[model samples]
Target chain A: MKANEVPQDKSSLDSINQKELCYATDESGNYITTKSSGWTPKTIALNNAIEDIKERAEEAKQRVLNNETSPIEYYMELNRMDVTILAGYVGIWPFRVKRHFNPKRFKKLSDKLLQKYADAFNISLKQLKQGDLNED
Target chain B: MKIDFKHHQSAHCENGVVSNLMKHNGLNISEPMIFGIGSGLIYCYIPFLKVNHGPAVTYRVMPGLIFKRFAKRIGVTFKREKFKSVAKAKQRLDENLKNNNPVGLQVGIYHLLYLPDHYRFHFNAHNIVVYGKEGNNYLVSDPVIETVATLDEKQMEKARFAKGPFAPNGQIYYPISFPKESDIPYKEAIVKGIKQTCRDMLAPIPIVGVKGIRMVAKLIKKWPKKKGIKVANHYLGQIVRMQEEIGTGGGGFRYIFAAFLQESSAILNNEKLMELSKEMTVIGDLWRDFALEASRLYKNRKATTGSYDKVSEMLFELADKEEVFFKTLKKAIK
Candidate 1:
């Protein structure tokens, strides 16, 4: 890619005030590091990934509202943590993490364990216990 | 206390850290040179490995190998450590700072409070340089960022000890000594680096190098039929992310390698390398073309039916181009 040909499309990276460093050849074919605000292809891919995360969180929230799953599931999706990643952060096994998604099992979780979950999600213990997603 | 570390931004982290550290230690090495001599460029499609529920597609060699290889090639030695205890990690880092040494750290991108929300993920292989500490905050030189950023003690601990595959476990490394510049064998290292890359790309393994790109092309053709649209799209997005994300510098290190070849031509005084460098740039553009189409397909923007096949065809072309490119490079260097 030529230095002048580097894309400057607006995307989430711009909204967050971050510009990526890209390497492109100058007019003479000498490589140069140019600051690119964004590129269309990269922007689309990132936005698509973010949208997928939002859609997953929305589904998890609906399940929580119906009492089919616990709010932990909602918060986990909201925090962009899958069961495996959330379990990794909470320092627990994957199966046990999935068990906590059950509403019944979740209610019986101890304060210490809830704190771990809260810490993993970077939320307070009260927030986890209340099961409130707040924009509801 | 902080060493006089002058931050020079680069397109990728490891190269940035290595280049910046080398500069600080009285040696000036361009990021592309460091990346090339390290033989950091690679393409591997691991079907069995799943990150974010999609097959792992990596554009570069494994993390840390680039720096390790580069240091060994240039006869520089570095002290490295990974701590199990967060407290011990903190103490060691502070000790290094007190001794006026800036150290490179491997930390998770997630929970790095200073970064924009969109960039943070659960991936644990991100690298940074902690130059000094001021009060509770550590001054960090993250290579991808425009300027130096800061991370507080609480946030730093979380990032350092982040658990997952490739978890850093509070890793810290810094060059202990550098060989005299005149003693370093630039021509020999470049020759070795190019040859190793040629061997890697032309290897007969089905899931590595140029063959790996073809394998992914085959898999892409089957994705929509097998995994459904949503998942197939997600997997496609993952590929683009891995290719264009902060570490790969752009076009999956293609541009850097192109620049490296150009630089190598001058040092070795070989005209063939210069011609090949231009060819590599064209190859980089080809990768961009593939990414553009693949992203458009996933974004559902004017993509027709069977667009997966379209992108897969592009990958096949890339495989062909790279196969020929590496073969030519092998002969040029030899």
Candidate 2:
């Protein structure tokens, strides 16, 4: 990792024009800070993580459409959360959160509780209630 | 009101925040010096703990400890507060700003609107400095960014109280009292930092320090055979991101530590530390090479079990290098 050897792979991070500061060695093997657009390895890793999250969100949306679970499931996955994390955000117990994942339970959820879920996912009441994954 | 804070960009968030805040308080400590004095580098692979839906792998010490440890080592103390309510948190923050005080805050990155989407995630251990306020927005110095940024009240509140796994809980800290800068024991602190890091890396534990590196290498070896290729690749991605991603300065803080060592060598007038610094940089390079190979495997779906094995072999080498590196480091300082 020479100072000039710092990679500029132009990944998603670079798309925002924010270069991350990285430490590399100079010709004398002395350390120096160089701003890098991004590294190819990090970009690939991040892209794969994003792809997996999107895939999971799609699966959750399909399950909601089929009435296997509620729209909260779809939104939770969309927000990159699992049951435990979503529960933490909504300030609900994990057991109760899992119960809300059931379509029947979600349908009976009070507006107050539904609002909490909606807020945690940063979506509107209508969006959470409709539970539609299609881009609108 | 603004506190006249100077922001110096660094590879990592906590070190940058701590260093910048110290500078604001009239101390000129480099980011690597802060990282080194804090003993912020470590390798811990917790199998049971899951973050990002994969086994938790920490490349640094737990969040918030670096500042705490750094302050303690330098014989200074920070006024630390965490509020349960967002309103109280905002009030305290504004009070500090009104007094022309810049404070470092532990915040969640997910809801920080100023961050790029690619870097924003559910991580709650991110640190930033709030230096001033103007009308509706607060002036922020996120050291990873090249320039200053801003966050309105609503966005600031959300980031401060972001829940789930190491929640920030509206934590804010600022130095209240300090010895004269000359009395700040750099020599003793440097020795202690080096000794503690050596102790940590050489600890005879299964899942921490050098042994932790070995444990992860072994797990990587068995991952493809035990789990499917997809899951194993996901796990590998977790490790790589933790290492090379933003804030690490690449090589899981190894380069930063090496830089620290290089600086420490000049400070302590120890030729042995200078040689060790070079060795640490070489170890950091090995870690980067490992990441490059592993990332390529997951990037292309054509990766075979043999490829995972090769990556695992790379990890084994890293573990060996780190083992010898820490041992020699321990003796060098002694």
Candidate 3:
């Protein structure tokens, strides 16, 4: 049930097969195996916890979008949001130039994101450019 | 503070009006070597005279002067002619033949090759001369001779016959000289090429100001990926730094050398790589290292320093460690 409760020395534990971890039917009427066979128990638990956090963060992001009083404050808050929020859908890090990364797909998605925000903020692209260039 | 015109001009004009011009300019003219045959010629004064010992020819910085007159008359000749023994004359001739330009007579002690005791007369002219022993008697031959004949009975006994015709009088030599060029085409071509290339590459950026890193990064981004932009960035910094350090007197050749070395080191063979390495101290090695690092990080490849990374690092570590290599090079040049 807990990591500490597992055997401290794995050497004395008789491997059910030649492998220390293996697939086997348990007493419970369901498909079951040693956690280490396909994935560690710790990894599965961490992934679930991460998903829960991401969902909560996304809900908070939507609420902020719906009740935004100032756009400047909203954009700043949006910038603070990490990529992990929508990472479930993307399944990969955006803005990464990896060997396997499809640059065209990433660029199209980024453009769409920029367009949505540009229309929402009521800021012209020229004004944005001037602001960036004229920044202190 | 007055200009010495006499030191400047080797020859005077036929009308002597040049001296009047020199006086008007507050200059004096003298010294044959300094100004020889310069009258009526548009002489470009050589900023520096570099004598190449390899060919025994001097490269005058002023191309015009080299082509005009010095190219013909500049030659090497012996001081005097002396011969004590047969062997001495032969040795002297051997030395003269080896010289790029050999002429005139030089007097020195002579050692008889055949006869140890009796002294022989040696003359150095266009050839060498020896008038002493072949075997049991006296003989004489031209310095150019491969063989010598002993005087026969009639020749040895008779006084008139002993004076051999083959003996060199006062002439034996080789001439060291370069073919005169009416114009120095090579130098002109080099200068023209430099000006053209400089205009194309540097004309866009007119400021004699610092090339900050952000602008350099933008420039690097525009460069082709295959061109090793990181390496170029390092050198672009050094190039601008070199201009600021040395000023325009040195021009962009230093930067050109740096850029060429940076790009060439990546693909060049070991021999050529080492050859270029000598010309590029900090800029080359640093840019090369930067390229290698970028290749490793961005391209997922091994370091470009190859197996000799440790050695290259150690050699470049001196000025490169402190990042003052260009400055050090500027100091050395100054």
| DockQ, structure candidate 1 | 0.63
Q: What is the lDDT of residue B246 in candidate 1?
A: 62
What proportion of the true contacts does each candidate reproduce? 0.59, 0.64, 0.00
> Per-residue lDDT tens digits of candidate 1, residues B1-334?
5567888778899899989889888898998899899998888988766776677888888889999989999899999999988899999999999999999999998878767666777788888899999999999998887788889999999999987778899999999988899999999999988988888888899988999999999999998888788788899988998888864633849988999999999999999999999999999998989988888788874444488999999999999999999999999987
Q: Which docking class does model 3 fall in?
A: incorrect
Over the stretch B1-334, how does candidate 3's per-residue lDDT look in tens digits? 1111121111111112222222223333111121222211110111122111000111111212221332223221113343534455555644543442222221111222322111121111111222333344434332211233243323332211111112232223222332333432323332232233223222233221111222333333433243453343333232222221110101112222333333333423223433332444333334334433332322322323332233223323422332243233223322
Error of 2 at A72 (Å): 1.0
* Cα lDDT, model 3, residue B222: 38
- Encode model 1's per-residue lDDT on A58-85: one tens digit a residue: 9988999899999888988887777777
DockQ, every prediction? 0.63, 0.73, 0.00
Task: Give candidate 1's error at residue B68 in angstroms.
Answer: 0.9
lDDT of 1 at B256: 89
Best by DockQ: 2
Evaluate candidate 1 by giving its C-alpha RMSD to the native, one decimal: 1.7
Tens digit per residue, CA lDDT, model 2, B1-334: 7778887888999999989988888888998999999999888888777777887888888998888889999988899999988899999999999998999999998887777777767888999999999899999999988888999999999899898889889999999988898898999999989888888988899999889988888898888889988999999998888777686733849889999999999999999999999998888888889998998899987678888888888888888888888889889887
Per-model TM-score versus the true fold: 0.96, 0.98, 0.16
Clashes of each: 0, 0, 28
Candidate 2: which stretches are off by over 4 Å? A134-136, B249-252
